[model samples]
Target: MLKKSDYRVVRALGHGSFGSVFQITEIASGKQLVWKRMTIVNDEDRKMALSEAEILQNNKSDYLVEYYGQFEDESEFYILMEYCEKGDLRKYINHLRELKAITSEDMLLDIFAQLTEAIFSLHSANIIHRDLKPENVFMTDNFIIKLGDLGMARVIMGTQQHLSRIGGTIQYFPPELLIQIEESEIAKTDLRPQEPVIQTKQCDMFSLGVIIYELITLKHPFADQNGEVLRTNIIKCKPNPLPNNTPESLKQLIMQLLCKDPTQRPSIQKNKKEKHQKKNKIKNQKKKNKKEKNQKKNKKEKHQKNKKEKHQKKNKKEKNKKNKKEKQQKKNKVKNQQKKNNNEKHQKKNKKEKHQKLNKEEKNQKKNKKEKHQKKNQKEKQQKKKNNKGKHQKKNKKEKQQKNKKEKHQKKKKKEKNQKNKNGKQQKKNKVKNQKKNNNKEKHQKKEEEEEKKEDEKKEEEEKKEKKKDHKDKKEDKDKKEDKDKKDKHHKEKGKDESSEEDKKGQVQHDKNKEKKEHHKEKDGKGEEKKEEKDKDEHHKDKKKEEKKKDKKHEDDKDKGKKDHHKKEEDKKDHHKKDEDKKDHHKKEEGEKKVETEKKEDKKEDKKEDKKEHHKKDEEKKEEEKKKDHSKKEEEKKDEKKKDHKDKKEDKKEEEKKDHSKKDEKKDHKDKKDKDEKKEEGEKKDDKKDHHKKDEKKEKEDKKGKKKEKGDDSDKGEEKSPNVVQAQDIKGDA
Candidate 1:
């Protein structure tokens, strides 16, 4: 269906030993793509070249290069794939190295993430990208990676391990693969039957680790020497440490990926999941930081507002004192004028000097009293200002200490959260590894058990068939013998002596009774065997049902666990929302209370200090009442939540009980039906046995009647001459 004429080659992209890649454009849509042309020399070469196209066609992923089509000519196999214009990761790494610059941690992590996704996609499809290297990874213009060059990738089925093959870059080969290769060669000399097979994905993981290490430090993690030295180094030597500048987490991840044992390497899915979790955590942290910043800003604004209110209050107090002093001075000046007028009137009537002397004395006394009052007022104002300043300073200090303590608490919480996350991740990794191992082991065991069961059943059925055939043959022989004996007895009764004929008749009757008894015994034995077989079959069926039920319960438990986890997360988010809402409400209420207090202070400005104090007390009482109400509401909400939780738990328990009861009922019904059917079958068998016994008895009675008739005929023959009878018997016997 594919034709090479549909695509026109633009330019050669790269060349390899077995293949060459070229940039190409489609004639129909003018879409550009990469054409990989492998020079096939034989059938094996062609098949190997076609494997990549087959794998890509069957499996598709966004991170991996897209497959378009494949075609082959006489000598070359051509496969078309998506074209990446920005070149490969190796070139990018080289360019960075040439510029003497280290790749940013974010960019490295992004590349690693993209590569992981691509690998995970391939792995999920059961295709191992054995040739994972920087050269195989291509970048788009936006720096997104597309994994290509899956020429060496192999698709494995089930849990089977692949044999070590000569593919992929030697520098990137994992220690396990390297050991497998060496052991394979050694096995030839040692005459060993099988060499250890390593997981192909781990080989890819090792390559990925090397690529990451190179990206970060622009150097290989392992020795890169030629020949045996490199092989030995890869097999035994540890990788070099990453640069100090690399993040601790990244360093740890790389080290784990480079572990010697294939089983120890972290799975790509785990890494992908962890990456997603990390991104979610980062986003949540950013949101929390923004909320905290907003809260801090609000606190600062409130503090500044409170400072401004205190400053305004101080100015108002100073201005009120100035006004009071001005009013007192004006009253004193008026009183002085009145006193002078009185003194002038008195001086005119009497002595002017006495009046002037009294006026002067009064003026001196008034001046002294005014001076003392001013000094007392100044001292009280100063003391009040000092007390207010001390209170403000104490409040600021307390706020600072609280802020510092909160910061410390937040830091500790973050540290604990990170530690818990780390521990959880490790536990999950171990759990997954253990689960995978157990599942694989169980699968293999189940397969073996099923095979053995099938074989045993086949053998049993074959044996039963052979036994049945033998039984049928014996029954046919017995039937023929009985017929021959009846004929002989008839002949004997016709011509033999009466006594001898009678004796022969009795012996035949006795043998017939014994044969019938034996036949009945065989039938009984067969019925019991059939019943045993039926019981065994029923037991097997019940066991299968129980196994199915157990599997279902296990699945249900997993689902319930996941549901519970999600529910808990949702509850935590809800509580966080409620707490934030409460904080906002409290802030709003505090602002309103401050405004009300300020308005009360303004209204009571002309009143005595005691009135202001009483108003403050009333405001405090109102605030306490509002707090009590909020607390009561909170308590009620908690109680309701508890009731709801209890109800939900009870409902779940009831549902479980109902389900269990229903299952029990179903089982009981099935058992009853089986019992009824078995009883019916047993009754039918009893009836059949009764009918067979009756038929046998009837046959026995008929044979007895015939024998008696023969005996009577023999008696009549006995009355005649014995010589004639003997002659006739001899003739009949001959």
Candidate 2:
């Protein structure tokens, strides 16, 4: 739950489209840290931002900037990182350039060593910093190089050639990457470059060489040209020669690093091994020099000791002879000195008394002088204090005058600021008035547009209604003609049958009854079909009416919403009232829609039930017709058998006819059953097709919703990395 308000911003370090970086101090801890705030819009951006933090956290190098922690809110991701007070290498180089100074050879070597060590650490972790430049290399107070800004870094698995988009500073690009730049230019500008550049650890080494060359020369090795020419030079030409003062070894090393082919460039691992060997060789040479100097010193000391010993022996012999002569002379002097000592003691006593009297006199004189000096010192102190008091008074008066001037100046500034603020407020008020007038005009225009749309919709609805009515009238006319044709055919058939069956009146009457029954059944079936069609039409009409009502309600609601919004803007005092009214209106509309849908469903169910009942009645009529025909035939057979009293062959023929008639009846029943089964199967297939269509629509809608959600997640764009100054060796995870 780390909030932006928790830390006080000192100043903005950088700003870009992705987010901003700030130098901030935690209020509670009072520690100054760099706060990198990234605005992440999608999952990919979020992963990239988090990878930087992860790299900083996992990498442990003395030359890498430390990662503190990270936190995020809904849309913004934050990273707290160590603040490098001395800034970056680019700034340091620029500072040296400003001073017209170049880095010493030893210092340059030291920087190069640290950079190699950082790159070695990253390479060991299989990470390649594709954007290595002086700007991305940070420095500490003690000039320790910290490699950072891994925004374009990628991780490669073993032996995998990374295919990458060409980015980073082109001047530092190796020859292999630079060669692709020309192909991109020849390509259409509208299309993205198709050629892929292979990025590897050697790219970082080449960039390191460029940074070193720039550090020494205070310019790019491929400098003195635009980007295009520089890239071409990097690819097809050589870097400018190092200065004459540059050591042969360093010159050779830089040249090797700037090799056109990446394979020719020295690897960081090889450089590290060579550095260790050089250190050991230097140590051994220092030991040999110390041994040689110690041997020379020992030889000189021995030679000096031999000379001193010989000279000391000669001096000792001469001193011994002189001591013997002095001993005899000292004995004679001691005898005379005993007598002189007694005489000298009396004279010494007299002198001592005179000296004591003089010393007392001088002490009195000194006391008188000390008293005079005290009085003079007191007068001088009084005069100095008086002068100091006047000086203090003058100082206070000057300070008061300065304070008064400052107050007056501040007052004038305040007055001017207030006047400016008043003018600004008046301008804002005028702008608001103008905005209100524009809004009013826009609202009027919107109302007119809506009216026109509504009118067009009304016309379309009317046209649809007319078309439906014409279609219904046409269908009715066709049904009438079909009914008239059926009647005419029935009458003609009745006349023809009457003429053919004049003698067999009973049989004809029976046939006529059967025909009448069949005609009536046909009429009933047609009537049922017409009723079913009418019901279907009514159901369709109800659905259309419901749809039109819902549409109109939606339009009305939209118009009301616009009017309410306008009212709220014009009359802010009644905002709450209008909101309540709007809520009520929406609820009312929703309830009405729901009720209408329920009624439509009920009507559909009624139509289904009616069709089912009609089917059951038709089946019942068919069964009754079959029973009546069978009973009529059975009675006719009984009367024939009773009246004939004829041959066995006649009876046998009658039986055969009865059996054939039964077989025909059975065939007819089976055909009817098959037709009913087929009709049921067709209806089932139609229902299944409708269900499938609905499911497909639902799936499409779901896909659209998901797409919309992803679209909403795609925010403005990612941030441009300035100088992250955070380690990135192991975090790309590629």
Candidate 3:
């Protein structure tokens, strides 16, 4: 049955646990309306919606979304509202995420202006938007921002009244609301809870602060680890500092809005007056000071001109004296340089003479040492030749006597030679054996030394590797710290740039105002100059007329001398009066002109200020664009840094992997060398055992067949004693 109506419910726009918003189209107008449907149709909810509708119906504003009508269906109650095509601010913020760009300041300012206007209107009507957030504010396709959601609004009057239940998202709750609730709960325990104190306009201002903070930073001011943490932090801890990039004006405004004490928050009227008065006072004082300074400077210049001629002669005398002094100083400087050069040349000559004398003394000492060494060598050679001549004759006589005795002793000598040869062979064997032992010991020592050297080299390499790793780690840490510092500095610079731009804009406006004032003054000066010229012309004409009258009276001077004199005196008095009147008129005209010029200048200043404001708006728009560009660049830089860091991390990982592989290779090489050394030691032990067994067999053969039994018995005895003692004795004999 409802399908045949003029309005058609297209779809649900939004839904909550107890209420839902439907997008409906009117068949006649083809316009859409958002229908908020409440399922739990209690008396309280109905009254709340009715009050909101009443407020909206009576208060008409461009900043506020219009309310249509409230109706009821079979199962639900529907409150109709103006359809905003662009939806709420929350959706817009989310949409911007896809674009990955922040909203411009112009858009923010537009929103703030509209919201402020709406708030002012609401306050005028004694209504406060207890819950004000982005979700409650809607925007149209044409960039019109409208405040909506009056479900939590309260009407303030003589008697404080509050809705029994608080309604708002926990995230956007102002500090006052929490305080009110706490106070109410305490009152309840004390049995004095007559009624909860009502919230004021300041509460809405607090919510506005949160919204502004969110808009500027693109994040909640009180966000924490999670929802619970956020609530705790908001209730207990102070909000974190806003981003350094936030504009100073916006930051200051938001801070004012966020004042925890309602009494401390800025009043709308007070803020406006303060800002305007400060601007006006600054402008006025600048103009007044400039005019006064100009007048003083003109007076000073006239006085200076009068004294200038009297000082000319003195100035000329001073100039001549200064020229003479400069020339004399230059001559003295030249003489000083000449003296320095002469001293330097004399010092150089003295140093050269000393160096030549030292070289001659060194050559003389070398010649004396050579002569002494040659004398000693000649004396020693003469003594040795004398001793050799005396010994030669005695050696020849002994040789002849020994030759006669040689035949008889020949046989005995041959036996002795045979025995000596055997002994010599034994000694040669012993020497060879000792040499082999020494060579073995030296080889072992060399091996040990080589092992120790290799160990030391490995330790040194390990230390070097550790130092390099530590250096690399420190460098990486320093780079990270530097990068962080650079980012902080860049953020601070961006903030300074924005503030400087604002200051420059303000200065430019002031300059334009000053120029307008100067232009007005110049026009006034020109007018005064014209008036002065006209007065001079009138005085000349009056003088001309009086001269003609005096000429006519000269003919009757004898007959009417006394009358003529009295008439002349009266005429002179009248002329003086006329001159005085003219002077008075001129003064009045100048004063009037000054007053009119001041008024005109004021108006011009106002107009100029308007234009400057418009220009400032344009500048602000440009600044918004600049800010967006800066944010984009910063984001790009952040991305680049992130990429660089990631690359560094990957490179570090690769380096670590390479180090691990190198460590594995070193361990494997060390293990292989250790195993080879152990194998060589085993072979040496086996060779020693074989040499011992051979020596034992030789001992048995040398004992002969008769004593073989005794040797075998001894061997058996040695074998029975222990292999260690027998091996030690055999190694010692070898």
| lDDT at residue 352 of model 3 (Cα atoms) | 59
Across 1-734, the per-residue lDDT of candidate 1 in tens digits comes to 88888889999988876699999987755567898999988888988888888988888866789898888887889998988878998899889978999888788887887788788888888888877878899987667678998887888778635664456766677776666554432211212225445556777888898888888888777644422226566677888777888889989999998888878988876655786785575457556756885787688778778988999999999999999999999978986775564444233323543476578668866975896688669757866875686578668756865786687679769967986998799799989999998797667556645754664575467447645754764575566567877764564344224323433443344334333333333334334355445445744664474355335434534534464457446755864675576557656766887898899897667556766786797679668856865786686568657755865786687569758867975796698558645643454454466567557655765666868877567556544644564356434323
Clashing pairs for model 2 are 18-719
Which one wins on TM-score? Answer: 2
Among all windows of 10 consecutive residues in model 2, the one with the lowest summed lDDT is 717-726
Candidate 1 residue runs with Cα over 4 Å from true position: 180-199, 224-229, 271-734
Residue 97 shift from truth in candidate 2, angstroms: 1.5
The lDDT of each candidate is: 0.70, 0.67, 0.65
Could you estimate the TM-score for every candidate? 0.35, 0.36, 0.34
337-368 in candidate 3: lDDT tens per residue?
A: 64464454234434554586467657755764
Error of 1 at 226 (Å): 12
Cα lDDT tens digits, model 2, 441-548, are 667556645754664475467558745754764575566567877765564455334322432342333334333333333324334355445445644664485456
